[model samples]
Target: PARRPPPSARRLMAEAGVAAAAIPPSGPGGQIRKEDVVRALEARPPAPAPATAPAPVAPAPQALRAVPEGDRERVVPMTPLRKTVARRLVEAQHTAAILTTFNEVDMTRVLALREQHGERFLARHGVKLGFMSFFVKASVEALRAFPAVNGEIRGESVVYRDRYDIGVAVGGGKGLVVPVVRDADARSFAEIEEAIAGLAKKAKDNRITMEDLAGGTFTISNGGIYGSLLSTPILNPPQSGILGLHKIERRPVVEDGDRIVVRPMMYLALSYDHRLVDGREAVSFLVRVKECIEDPERMLLEV
Candidate 1:
């Protein structure tokens, strides 16, 4: 005999317009919990429309296989992590006055620096010198210069953080997960590389814990690795800003004296909460990042 859902669960199912038989019980002793009701609501199909005149439909081309309609489509359930991501993304868009600002950076100096020190840095640090370290360092400098970008909006107030806990977005086995690099401002290049590597491995193995995904003052998402040419990254909630990095390509540009030259350029986008950060500050923050990447010495000099 199956146990019936409690009165609270029944009320929830009623409010959600789902039938009791439609929800599966996962609670102890075959009881339907509120969570089960919610899942059912999420999975429920739309109600059929009232009967009306049937519209003419076109026949499928004979060349197109004769496979059944069901065989051509598949339905898969969203993982818990993916569901949370979807919810948070929608929440961020709805709650915040989100805006994106774009800028292009010449990666010539940074690439040269990497090529010059790749072997030695790897030999000493046991982690290859990657572009992320440079970006993280540059972002730290930029965030420090524009504190509002690193701050969050708490009802009626803007909270600024002195510590830099940067979240590096990585694709995990489950989905995309952002694991924080705690106190990034104090970490050396080697330490930052090691931290990102460890977090990436954990994400790939699906062994990341909630603590690793906890509080971050800012987030950096590198879509360049996946060959994304350009994209506007959405803000991670509670954080005022997110930085999106795109692919580096050789493009012709005008230099000093109007000389056209080929340069490796990467597009940078800063998506910020307009409620907390003004347009001037957001643009300045992105420009600051561009300057640090282009020069590569300003970050070292604390400029």
Candidate 2:
């Protein structure tokens, strides 16, 4: 399930070194959103005047008069879905030893591959080839390479999931929701795209059921669609890891033989429950994803 706040907002709070719970959420259903973060920063109280400073002159009589109350106050109760998101996030913070690591991937190859094969693929599957399938397949490969990232802690034991059930975060009318793609590891790229398309439709239409939202081993949240440049994702309860995708921008970088060129780059963040997955495992998992996305053929070849 998606957290009460978008993962990007939570990441912003962490990056600013602020307490997550202390900030007030102005988002729908009292969830902290990106705008709320900006508001909090802008509204922060300035440092108090020094004790030695003179107690300045009093305000004019007209300025001293109490200002009439304006129509600025409003309250909305939390929806059940939002309440569930809040409770689970707090529980995750208290229970899991959460940590996040980041990396950047060059999307040059993936973009080229899509452009070359997209037309044929669309004609055959009746769906346009998109980036989600590449990432889903890449994630499945990465999860296979590092099972700990897919595993969850149960009581005193770590449960390793044999099958890949990935939750793709989508925005719905109510709030953000995650619908699972069952057995993702076994699905082809076209299949993955179609599944995501169908699920996203159901989500936007508010027709997704509880069964669609349940039982996921891992999750992928793409804040890039909403223009987030980078973010550290929060873990969904019981799951050990979640991946965050950010906006792709063209940036210059040095390649082999001291050659510099501009390439489409996207930042990736992996947040894992350190209680179950180690730093090495988390880092390696992210690297594996980067490799697969950088060379889409690796997924097709099962390399």
Candidate 3:
């Protein structure tokens, strides 16, 4: 004789739209308990329609189907850091009027400069001279030019920060983490690269601390390494602006508005809080960054 689930468990399964036959019993003497019914509800796939239902109600060819028991989908809980990131991202979207502006930078000079001095720079600094340092320096210069982009809205007052602490987004073992490069305006290019490297190591090792991510006047996210051609990045909360760097690809461009030549170019995206930074300021800020990158000497000359 097969043991039946208790009346309460059966009622709960019915109320939850779960079939009694689908639930496995785990109670004493093979009786189905309420917990067993709840587990079945959580693990259940969408119910199929009755055989007598209309033929037109059939699921589409692309609709999901249940797999074998061994190939069932696994449900894993989100970590605390992941949960926090989710909440903050939603909050940023809701609380700020966000806008993203795009621009493209010709990487001719920067790439040439890197090709020439990259080996020497790495030998001296013990770290590779990556595009991020250039972008960081460029961002510092841009922020200095457009103070409004570095400013945030606090209550009814616009809080403009004098210090430039740039946040570099890095992929961590748990998820993405943004670590700050403190006093970026004062740091040398090599120093900025070193700070990013160290922070990235800490993040990969899952040793990144709250203090490491405490505050930032601005953020930079480079999706170039992952082969993204272009993407509009979302704003990180409390900060007025974020710069997104994408993959550099060879594209034909007119030189002096006549000669077409192929050159390596990268698209840049500046996502800012429209509530604080106007469209003109946002566009100009991105343009300033492009100017610095296209003419790498401008960053060195501090022009």
Candidate 4:
């Protein structure tokens, strides 16, 4: 004989379509815990016919058993980090006058540069040469040229930042976290790569702290790693803009001599708070990033 369960546990079992007698007690004094009910409910199969009366009725189809409802669904509460992300996303939508500008860049030169210097760079820095450092440096130059992208609206006035602290969005075990790269403008490419690698490791291992996640004037999200072809990213709160980078693909395009040729291309999206940045400035800022990415040397020359 089984002891009666608490009102709440009984209600949960009833809702889960689990019989009180079916679950074994795992709590103290042979009491059935709510978790016991949940586990039993999750494991219970569809009801079969009576042992002696099953000859007349056919079994339910396998497809029917796969229908998603009741026992098929398991609900869990949102984690605190997920809740925070949701709140900030909604707040960004409501608070900022957001707009996304788009462009595409030829990656021929950047790829060539990487192929030429990647091995030595990796040996020297102990971190693989990656595309992120190039983009970070390019973004800094563009931010310098178009200060409005780095500016934030504080109450009634706009505040401009002189130093570049760029946030790189990384997927952590908890959720999407943006860890800031401090003084990115002044850091060398190797230094930027090393910092990004360290921050990424911290994020993945759940060692990231509040200081690592704060004080970013701008953000860059690389959806390309996850195979996103193009997407309009949302703004992070208090920050005026975020740059979305997508997968690089080989596409046919007209080159300098109007000859149709295949080239590696990547689509770029810049999502900005329109209240602080004008459309012209936003477009120009993206174009500047494109120029630097396409030529890499332009970033060195500060052009």
Model 3 agreement with the true structure over 1-303: per-residue lDDT tens digits: 457787757777776777766777767777888657755654555555568955586654766765557875786766656755776798799999988999999999989988999999999999999999999999999999999998989889999999999999999998898999999999999999999999999999999876688678999999998999998888888899999999999999999879999999999999999999999999999999999999989888988
What candidate 3 gets wrong by more than 4 Å, as runs, is 1-70
Error of 2 at 91 (Å): 1.4
Candidates ranked, most accurate by TM-score first: 1, 3, 2, 4
Comparing 1 and 4 by TM-score, which wins? 1
lDDT of 1 by residue, 1-303 (tens): 778887757987776677777788887888887657656764566555689988897797988877676676676767656765787799899999999999999999999999999999999999999999999999999999999999998878889999999999999899899999999999999999999999999999989876688689999999999999999999999899999999999999999989999999999999999998999999999999999999998788886
In order, what lDDT does every prediction score? 0.90, 0.87, 0.88, 0.88
Q: What stretches of model 1 exceed 4 Å from their correct place? A: 1-71
Using lDDT as the yardstick, the better of models 1 and 2 is 1
Residue pairs whose backbone atoms clash in candidate 2: none
Question: What's the number of clashes in each of the models?
Answer: 0, 0, 0, 0
Candidate order (lDDT): 1, 3, 4, 2
For candidate 3, the TM-score is 0.78
lDDT of 4 by residue, 1-303 (tens): 556687657877776677767888876777887657655653455455468843576767976765456556686666545655776799899999999999999999999999999999988889998999999999999999999899899879999999899999998878789999999988999999999999999989988765687679999999999999999999998899999999999999997888999999999999999998999999999999999999999788776
Output the worst ten-in-a-row residue range by lDDT, candidate 3: 40-49
Residue 166's C-alpha lDDT in candidate 4?
A: 98
